[model samples]
Target: MSSHSKSLGEFDLIERFFKTGANSLRTTADSAIALGIGDDCALIRPPADEEIAITSDMLVEGRHFFAGADPELLGRKALAVNLSDLAAMGAKPLGFTLAIALPMVDKIWLEAFSKGLFAASYDYSCPLIGGDTTAGPLTISITAFGSSPTGKAIRRSGAKAGDDIWVSGTVGDARLALAALRHELNLPNADLQNIAHRMHQPTPRIELGIQLRGIASAALDVSDGLLGDLRHILKQSQVDAEIQLNQLPKSITLQKQGIGIQNQFAASGGDDYELCFTAPSTQREKIHTISKILNLPLTLIGKILPKKDVEVRIHLLDASGIELSNSEAAPFLNSFDHFAS
Candidate 1:
């Protein structure tokens, strides 16, 4: 912890740090939000004919990040991850509430963190509605709210056989950065600098997701590895997938690594907040046009298949189009699990 402000009270801290500028009040005329901060409970109504989408994400000091991590980046990431959930659902941002725990009131950290938080808030047009602040171990929990057309929000359970699986941007750079940071993989300082932002400050594909609303049969944001997150869609939709290992998009930084490392990280490395979605084969032209319009690459990595059994399976294939056995695929099967022994 940095220097502590022993005298700063809770409300005073909120007013000084969180409740100011655009966050001071809901001055902007948003029909969806009826009330904002300074109230016991903030009030929001979904837009007429639209449904609300809500999601929460928590980040702990030691588990999610290192001690004394950059407060600005951490603050941005805390909300960004939650916003990514909204993107996965093809929802439009509305607002968010932040509940934070701190060992003590570190003024410097608060200032930087709040700056970064509001920066994202402004960028995504998601205001800080209300939340709580308390004294405890360093932790950040954010609940973001969004809205989408009623009966039109994309879901994990909508994928069907013959749909094409697509991924926006690239994956595995975040894991690559983590590996280099842990010294598990040797990398140059310059390379680390280039890819560090993938882990630290990820871009949520909000526009791309909204564009994919009617097109995508199912969608999800890749936070906990591509394969692991895709499993959610498979299980929910009662389908399977066959992914070409070579087709999984990789950043130039990750491509420089050995093939084995590249496969493992791209398949199972967490913290890549890219969008992975499934769409019909007929919509290929529209999806490609969306890629051009958004300038975000949407790569077709695989296809959804009929469920073979009760088990939801994702078959992995090599460049030569040969399926790998369980033992051969083990390295890329395990994703980031918070409670694995």
Candidate 2:
């Protein structure tokens, strides 16, 4: 621990590092926060007819990330994951609170971490309201707030049979990076570098979520593997889904792998912070236009099906769109389970 950081108390640390102009997002009178840091409690007043959307996430050392990782990237990812939840609900970011636990105060690490945190805040226009700091094992917990028009927040329960399933951006790159890091797969330096960004600094599709409010029937952020998160929608909507393996989008880095590897990672690899949504076939043109406008690839990968006999299920299909037998899909059906050892 640095002598400078050791000399400072928690309050002093906050005043010197966090309670600065750089972290302030309330530059205008119309900002979401009525009162920011320094108060006992931050004040937020959403616009009329809008509903507040709140989400929280926690990142623990050794589990979520490796120890001695880049502080800047860790700070950014800590908040980005929560924002992804808001994006899934089609909400506009209002502000957020950060509660962090640190084993010891390191000035240099704190500086870099705060820089990355505020950078993401400014980029997303979400201000830091208030939170708590404590001494413990290194952990980052963030609670993000957002707003959407009343009755307009998209949800997993709204997906209907016949809705086309869509996924934004690419998948599998983050898992591929993890595989390389774990030595399960061998990758060149360039490939490792390319996929590492996807694992570290994932972009939350806030704009895409806002635009999809009326058009998409149901949506979610793909945090756990695509298939796993999609199951949430299926359970909520009481429906089944059929997806084509070939339609899952992939980055150039992930595409370099073999077909089995590509399929495995795309189906069950976690940490792909992309939006997975369902829309009616009639809105295909509008979705395509939105994709062009955003310059983000939105691929139709599947369709929701009626739950005839089963409670909820998924049909895995091949490149030719033929449904795979139980034997063929056994490998791809499971996803990352935190409790599964």
Candidate 3:
């Protein structure tokens, strides 16, 4: 691949693989895109009366994923993580721009990666508008564009003292897969395969986010971990929260693990891209109905609390309603930090 890469100029690489793949994924949003690839820049017009929500995510080899991970899944995840950011804001995906640095232009890898990337673009109705290609370490960065009704995007600062905290789908499976892959834990091969997709191809809760508009008071995607990410809302809203450790939703595979494993991973699993949100207690019935409508489980795991004159932002509780001490909950309190050593 490296030898052949010498013959593949950057322009030729983009035109043959990326641009062609992107053109095939164009959607109705094309009308809003005044100019796409083959130009200095891509121009897109956000829908009238809507505000654009933009987000960018970058993945680097050996940092975000293994050095020789599947290119197809990596491609899907590159855009999916960015789309999850849009979903966090209750926005509809419009388009995306990808900036990728390749160690070498491998045709086979490019074909598989482009297939997965464009597949996700079509699935979310987000076409590839424009981007740049370069030569460097294997890294992919995607900036996604989305739109939401003016002033209606859900935010982390909207949680009130009495709001009910909820989470969409389940958590912990991604981290479980990681632990097994790293040999930190052992699992049946079948079970590992079952949960591996949660780590590789996360589903962006875009539809649920759109439906949460005006319903959810505050929301964010659980990328960094459930307990750690929830602190963002508490800090922003100047509120506190109490969550039942046992109430966190987990997949059947994850449930097979011990309680300690469940609590640690479910509370602090970093890559689960599910939606954790807050809504009024009065809207519990409504949220339940929406869960049924979407065929997604909406679990009520906690409640918001009025801010007390204390440093703690949230408390973890056992089934007996006893709050765990800071030391007892210490392991689950920290979120994933990219630069932490």
Ordered by TM-score, highest first, the candidates read 3, 1, 2
Compared with the true structure, all predictions reach lDDT values of 0.87, 0.87, 0.89
In TM-score terms, candidate 3 sits at: 0.95
List RMSD in Å for every model shown. Answer: 3.3, 3.3, 3.0
lDDT of 2 by residue, 213-309 (tens): 9999999999988988999999999999999988999988889999999998998889999999999999999999999999999999999999976
Model 3 score (lDDT): 0.89
Model 3 residue runs over 4 Å out of place are 1-11, 310-312, 337-341
TM-scores across all candidates?
A: 0.94, 0.94, 0.95
lDDT of 3 at 328: 94
Tell me the RMSD of model 3 versus the true structure: 3.0
Q: Which is the better candidate, 1 or 3, if ranked by lDDT?
A: 3
Query: Best candidate per lDDT, number?
Result: 3
Count clashing residue pairs per candidate.
Answer: 0, 0, 0
User: Candidate 2 clash total?
Assistant: 0
The residue-by-residue lDDT of candidate 1 on 1-341, one tens digit each, is 11135434653655546867445534342457787777677889888999999999999988888888899999899989999999999999988888888888778898899878888887888888887776789989999999999998999999999999999999999989988888888999999999999999999889988999899999999998999999999999999999998999998889999999999899999999999999999999999999999999999999999999889999999999999999998778777663232
lDDT of predicted model 2: 0.87
Which prediction has more favorable TM-score, 2 or 3?
3
| lDDT (C-alpha) at residue 62 in model 1 | 84
Q: What C-alpha lDDT, on a 0 to 100 scale, does residue 224 get in candidate 3?
A: 88
- What does the lDDT come to for candidate 1? 0.87
